[model samples]
Target: MEIVLYIAALVAAIGFLVLCVSLAMTLTSLKKTLNEVSGTMSGLEGQLQGVTRETTELLHKTNELASDIQSKSEKLNSVVDAVKNVGESVNGLNTSVRRITSSVANEVEKNEEKISQVIQWSNVVLEIRNKWKERKAIDEGRSGYSNFKD
Candidate 1:
């Protein structure tokens, strides 16, 4: 009976030792996994910081570009306004020219008969001048022949 009690006590002690060893191994593996996770989190944090900085710079550049475009658009608007004014002035000039042309056409139409009578008088004067020249030439020829006869 004493030998059996001693054997039972030794077996219980061995089982406890085995449980402790297994617990220690499991704890060590869990520590290594935790360390790998910490390292990965640190790398991700650094990458996130870099991305934030680049995003900030890109946002600033985009704002500057927008401001420049707005300024140019304002200048372009002024140019467009000037072109519109020029078009209006040209339209006014065209209207004035049309009015003057219409007035001249109306005056010419009103004086159509007077213009025709003036043209007929000019032709009659030209015909009288031609007739006078022919008479002078005939008188000179007669005087020359009489002198030859004498």
Candidate 2:
């Protein structure tokens, strides 16, 4: 019976040694895998830093571009205001011209009969002057009296 116990204990010890060896092999494989993961993480961190820097630069450029656009827009607003003022001035000038034209047209319409009478009077005056000149020429003997007409 003692011999049987000794053999059993020896077999158990052997089994324990085998388990330790298997565990060691597994831990060694795990260590190698961890080292590879760490190296990959380092590379990923470097790429992330580069991306962050590029994003920051891009953001800064965007801000500058926006600022430039704002300045240009402000300058354009002044031009727009000037154009609006010019348009208003043109409208005022057109109104003034229209009023003057309307007043002149109204005055001409209101005095049409008077203008016609004045024209008739001028014709009568001219005829009288011509007759007087013919009479004088005849009396002075500057023209043949027989050639004079009434």
Candidate 3:
């Protein structure tokens, strides 16, 4: 019985030593994991800062482009107004030409009767002159002249 007691005491001491070693190893592993987490957090922060700077620059550039487009739109509007003015002027000229053409046509219509009368008078005059020349030639031939005098 005394020998058995000594063996039992030795086994308890060995078990206690094994427990202490396991606890130490667990603590060391936990410390290493915490360090890795800290390193990863620092890397993420650096990336976030870079993204923030780039986003600020992009916003500024977008605003500048918008301002430039606005200026160009204003210029384009002026050009469109000028073109509209030109179109109005051309329409006015077209209206004037149309009025003049109508006036000329009206005048020509009014003169149609006078032109017809003049043509009739000219024809009558030509026929009378020819008849008069024939009569004079016949009269001279009967009067024993060789030819009618001019």
Instruction: Pull out the clashing pairs in model 2.
Output: none
Write down the worst ten-residue block by lDDT for model 1: 6-15
Which tens-of-lDDT digit does each residue in 52-149 have in candidate 2? 99999999999999999999999999999999999999999999999999999999899999999999999999999999999987787844655584
How close is every model to the real structure, measured as TM-score?
Answer: 0.62, 0.63, 0.54
Candidate with better lDDT, 1 vs 3: 1
Candidate 1 is scored at a TM of 0.62
Summarize candidate 1's per-residue lDDT along 52-143 as a digit string, tens digits.
99999999999999999999999999999999999999999999999999999999899999999999999999999999999999999999
Give lDDT: candidate 2, residue 40.
Answer: 100
The 10-residue segment of model 3 with minimum total lDDT is: 141-150
Models sorted by TM-score, best on top: 2, 1, 3
Off by over 4 Å in 1: 1-26, 118-150
- Residue 98 lDDT in model 3? 100
In model 1, pairs of residues that clash are none
Rank the models by lDDT, top first.
1, 2, 3
Per-residue lDDT of 62-142 in model 3, one digit per residue for the tens? 999999999999999999999999999999999999999999889989998998999999999999999999999898787
Error of 1 at 135 (Å): 11
